[model samples]
Target chain A: MKVILVGFGVIGKGVVKVIDKKKNHLKSKYGLDLKIVAICDRSGAAIDENGLDLKTALKVKEETGKISNYPEKGKNMSIVDVIKTVDADAIVEATPTNIETGEPAKTHMIEAFKNGKHVITANKGPLALYFNELTSYAEKYNKIFRYEASVGGAMPIINLAKETLAGNEITEIKGILNGTTNYILTKMEKEKLDFDTVLKEAQELGIAETNPHQDISGLDTAAKIVILANSIMNKNVSIKDVKLEGITRITPEALTMANKSGYTIKLIGEVSENKLEVGPKLIPIDDPMNVKGSLNVAMLNTDLAKEVVVVGRGAGDIETSSAILSDIISVYLRTKNE
Target chain B: MKNNKKQKYNNFNKTLYYYGENMITLDLELKDIPGELIRALTPISNMGVNIFSVIHLREKKTDGRVPVRVVISDAGNRLNEVINKLEEMDIIITKVNETTRKTDIDIVVVGHVVDTDVRDTIDRLNKYGLVVDLDLSMPDPFKESSARMKVIIETDKLDDLCKELDKISEEKNLLFIKSF
Candidate 1:
């Protein structure tokens, strides 16, 4: 599998590690030649055309915290330059989520499809923002666009909604789609931590970003729900349409009192009855609604059945990277040229 | 005639409540033992509270416990009554949370060693401070036939429920399933 990775952040780095780890098994067993030919960060880009040295690149990342100073073996280029010019099977679009306009990643996804390249991404903003248009473009260009990691971290929710429940009409979809918010809420309830306390702890735990409004304010979940709604319904939806809520308003006293009251706090995103809203609400102690810590996400009220809830580790380097690999493998299978 | 009208109005002394309002559904968990579900629910039902829907599916865990999902009418201050009833019943509840419909939250109080004393968990939720809103029954036969229930209460009480559930679960050999 030949590929190019964009934005070598934590998740992107994880993907590279997995590919490196499995390269031997894939080659010896399946005759697969996994190659990450190019890597690009905002500062600079490196292209080996053959393949970048994964070991040196990783060491460089560990040392400098960036994918620079690796002796620049390949043709050094810009991210846009690499995306436009690279000859790879797919683009791993793991850029920083630009929620405002969904710019570069969105544009880059289009470019990849137009240029006959498939896409596998963990960027939620672009998918949530342009699900309809992009899916249409994929169809137009005969490309594959897959984003399982965008929501539920590593949970196979996208597949659950699209493939498993394809037979059902899927009248409703709901879950605690954000790990950061759920972690904060859990800390607040368990350690008696407040939102800010839990939130800061989340940052220390590497579960949240420095400016985590997207995760804390429920915007991340809103984007995820919008993506699910659009994917299931196959329509173009806007974030504005989904009701939004954040954990910032919650207090320690409230969580403590909620304990006194027998309720758990979770930031939820729901879409059903032709409407979607996102916010924190009190869930019962045993409804499978109050999944705690970083493990969460559930789907209820499907078309063919009553309620089916799926749970697992919602976030992890391995899990998220595996999702991206799934996207890549899917693209490889679809365009295998066999 | 005017004196008669004034007297009639005074005699009525009735409180008016508006209808057609959306009710938030809350999910709750308690002991699956005997008399627990009724103890958790009767207090609220007698207070004129309406239930929207109840989903009771025994978790199918070998531990012999139950899980219930429920919806209720979210009218006026009915939340307070529901919370009081669950606390009274020692049942732990989370706000009945849904999306694209209404803003609600989901909570749970998991039980372990449920095979022996099914009602022990729910009984604890009914005691004090912890709020509850709904109660349900599991459908499976030959499994003590525990009830599945959903309840809604305030968000602030979540930690207290976890602490209490942890404490109870520790002593009772209960499987404190965390809320999703």
Candidate 2:
């Protein structure tokens, strides 16, 4: 699969590193001859008519903060132009999520679909807001749309629900969906500290963003719920459909009280036929959904087999990019089948 | 099998697998009454679905019920029949997790749900082929209970789910509030 990766931020770099590490393995094991035709960042896009030397491109990106310094770079073309003109089989949209507008990434995905290119996105905005439209576009153009990294990072919740548990009907999906809030909650629970104190530590550790409204206010989890509801359980719902609550109101006293009651307070996103909500809830201490630290866990409730829970890191560069790579392989195999 | 050192560097873990062609996990909420959990799992065992693992949260209590998570794989093609039997037994088969290309709609059913027998209403809705998943909150067995449910049905069947909700409201004398 010849690819063009847009948004050369942390996830983009992570994708480059994972592809480089798994280059030979993918070809040998999966029969996927993966190649990168172009790479783009916020500032500019870099193109190589043939495959680009990603290692050298990574070195340049690390040193100069731009891939335009690559040996065969075009003069900073727009991402749209690169997506339109690049002779590639897939586009990896790794841009930061913008739920408000679904922005440049949404337009980029639309452009990719218009050009009959498969898409793998880490951005949640487009999927949360316009899942039906984008999915329909992919079908109309006969392109594969995969966004494993959008929810659960390396946990593979999307793929697990989509592929592993294939026949049983999914009734509900409950998850410790966001790592930042979970981190804050864990710290508050273990250290008996308040939300602000733990949040400051999280910000310093680079787990929570400087402007941490989305992560703290439960919007990020809401976005993930929307994507999961639409992609897996097949609901045409959006963030607005979720009854949102954050951990900001949770106090150390409350945590201590919950502990006394044999429960742990964690932000849980519950998705079912009649309910979509993300808020701090009291999960039993031994419950699988009560995973600690930055780990993410999703418990899928089904009719036939019962309940299955998957747990893994919900963030980090390599972890999330691993999801993008899986989506890439899915597209590769699907394309081969076609 | 690869060595641990080599596996450590391999970032991608292959999870896109179907234990066979059909694997599912059920999230069930059984009435705290004795034998309810047994009643739920008996048909599953009888149908010969490969039991992967079962996690029964006996200590966790919600809505005066015990939440159990059962993982099973069906290669013999009898999983649906097992579910149908469970439903007929009024075992409160709370959630059926399977893979489908259907939209999931979540809503909240508030007030006196358990008194109206939510299981019967769900079974009635199932008659229309609208798959339903419930997370109920009936903290006190003697009082009113609300539920959060995810309805997995085709896009065209959304109206059907809504109409069913309306019917459930009228018949059960409850308020159905769709989560925004």
Q: Which number leads on TM-score? A: 2
Local distance difference test, each candidate: 0.70, 0.80
Candidate 2 similarity to native, TM-score: 0.67
TM-score of each model's chain B = 0.41, 0.46
The TM-score values for the models, in the order shown, are 0.65, 0.67
lDDT of 1 by residue, A77-161 (tens): 6777788887888889888887778878998899888888888999888888888889989999998889988887777888777
- Candidate number achieving the greatest lDDT relative to the actual structure: 2
User: A-chain TM-score per prediction?
Assistant: 0.92, 0.98
Model 1 Cα RMSD, 1 decimal: 17.0
Model 2 chain A, poorest ten-residue lDDT window? Answer: A253-262
Compute the lDDT of residue A205 as modeled in candidate 2.
91
Point out where model 1 deviates above 4 Å.
A28-30, A64-68, A72-74, B1-180
List DockQ, one per candidate, in order. Answer: 0.05, 0.03
Candidate 2 overall Cα lDDT vs. reference?
0.80
Separately for all candidates shown, the number of backbone clashes (residues 3 or more apart, or on different chains) is 79, 39
Candidate 2 on A1-338: residue-level lDDT in tens? 79999988899999999999999999999999899999998777788867888899899889998888776574578899999998999999988779998998999999999997999999999899999999999999988899999999999888888788889899999888899999999999999897899999999999999999999999999999989999989988888888777777666655655565456778888899888888777676777788999899999999986999999999989999999998998889878866
